[model samples]
Target: MNTTKLNPPTQKNRLITMILAMFLGIFGIDRFYLGKWKSGIAKGLTLGGLGIWWFIDGALLLMDAFLHSLGKDSGFVKDARGQDLRLGLSMYRLKDGRLQRDWFSS
Candidate 1:
């Protein structure tokens, strides 16, 4: 097994994902970027009208990002640069073979 560690996404990406999730979560765009293809599609099919549950989900995603940016561990997957990697999208590969998805690249 290739035990290669997976990196997180950049701050910019995280913000983008959060914004999309908040605004278009009803369409599952956020979920799609989060690697939750099934859920994303389901949300889209249902028009995200699954009652208050979908609203709560959006709130949680925003909170997660807020917590992470506060220097607090969000208990989520982070890229090599310690940035939270959303899902679906791949970060840049570092020279050391590690992945980085940060706003600033070396």
Candidate 2:
């Protein structure tokens, strides 16, 4: 078995995901982060299913982000790029084969 320690994930920024969903949700940019392309496309194609789907999707994202804000995991899958989200400040990362804590913080 090729066992290796992957650096812990960046602290999945709730704010960033929420902001993306609020603005570019129609384009599924927010869904891109959660690796939810299927639903994202559906919303984008149906014009948010005449607004209903859009609202629901936004609400779900907001709820998940809020749950995560309480120092708890939202249980959502990791972002596809596994990169830092600009809106998700206070993120962490792996650098030099080690953990980079608070990567975006000053």
Q: Which candidate is the best by TM-score?
A: 1
**Candidate 2: Cα lDDT at 58:** 72
Instruction: Name the regions of candidate 2 deviating beyond 4 angstroms.
Output: 1-4, 7-11, 70-72, 75-106
Q: lDDT tens string, model 1, 39-102?
A: 7788888878663546866677666655544434343533334555532222332323444443
Clashes of each: 4, 0
Candidate 1 Cα outliers beyond 4 Å, as residue runs: 1-12, 75-106
Residue pairs clashing in model 1 are 7-79, 8-78, 8-79, 9-85
Query: TM-scores, in order shown?
Result: 0.57, 0.54
RMSD of 2: 7.7
lDDT of each: 0.58, 0.58
lDDT of 1 at 101: 47
Task: Tell me how far the alpha carbon of residue 21 in candidate 1 is from the true structure, in angstroms, after superposition.
Answer: 1.1
Q: In angstroms, how far off is 32's CA in candidate 1?
A: 0.6
